[model samples]
Target: MGFRVRSPQDFWGGIVLIIIALIAIWASRDLAGMRGFAFGPGTAPRLFAGLLAFCGALVALVGLLQDGPKIGAYAIRGPLFIVAAILTFALAVRPLGLVFATYVTFLVSIMASKEMRLIESVIAAAAMTAFCVGLFTYLLGLPFQLWPPFMY
Candidate 1:
């Protein structure tokens, strides 16, 4: 019998999780671990990475055991928009500041929705911007600039 992935979602999800866990584990290799039973900087991250890898393997096993539906067409728009939104937020945060960056990110992410409404998106962006500014700057006292440096 030809081997096949019973559940495409579970199999692919497991693979992604495993990859992320491996990367995390590798990246945290330099961090110090337990010293005389006291947890060090790498302890928690290593533990979490191990757990992620275990969960991914479990998911893959379950996928292999179960007979599932065929894989459907992948939707690129949602993922693309979400990734773009995240990148935009990262790039804009230092230059445009938190409020504008958050607003722009929210606006860009809304484009992923098929039923996106302009007014709703704008309102959502504004609300998100306000919430981020208030939480990070005012409430948490993060010292993030509300506007661009040139605007100061």
Candidate 2:
């Protein structure tokens, strides 16, 4: 009997993850990892990449071995919203600053959920903004601007 993929989506997901992991490993290969006990920038990336690759392989193997449901229709809304949120954050962070950008990102991402409530989203946004400000600004002492230039 020919090999049948039990979960086409999971198998494909594994393949994509493996490909990404391979690319990461290749890109990080040239980065410095000095000899003997000296771990450089590449070390963590390589370790993570290796782990990702292994996990991807395991997922693929599981997909192959088990009988699973057929792949269903792909949903674009969640992914699109998440990408938009990330892009919004990247674009807004410099001009709008951390707190505003974080709030916007949280708000944008919340739209991806079908059961999203406005009040909950607002609360989440505020909490995320405060947490990010506390972590990056106060605890880590990062020099991120908290507000727009005009507000300063």
User: Which candidate's TM-score is highest?
Assistant: 1
Q: 1-152, model 1: which lDDT tens digit per residue?
A: 98988888788878889999999999999999999989999999999999999999988877787876666888999999999999999999999988888899999999998999999889878987888888888899997878899998
- Provide TM-scores for the models: 0.59, 0.56
lDDT for each candidate structure: 0.90, 0.90
For model 2, residues 61-86, the per-residue Cα lDDT tens digits are: 88888877777887999999999999
Q: How far does residue 19 in candidate 1 sit from its true spot (Å)?
A: 6.5
Task: Locate the minimum summed-lDDT window of 10 residues in model 1.
Answer: 62-71
Which stretches of model 1 miss by more than 4 angstroms? 1-66
Which 10-residue window in model 2 sums to the lowest lDDT? 65-74
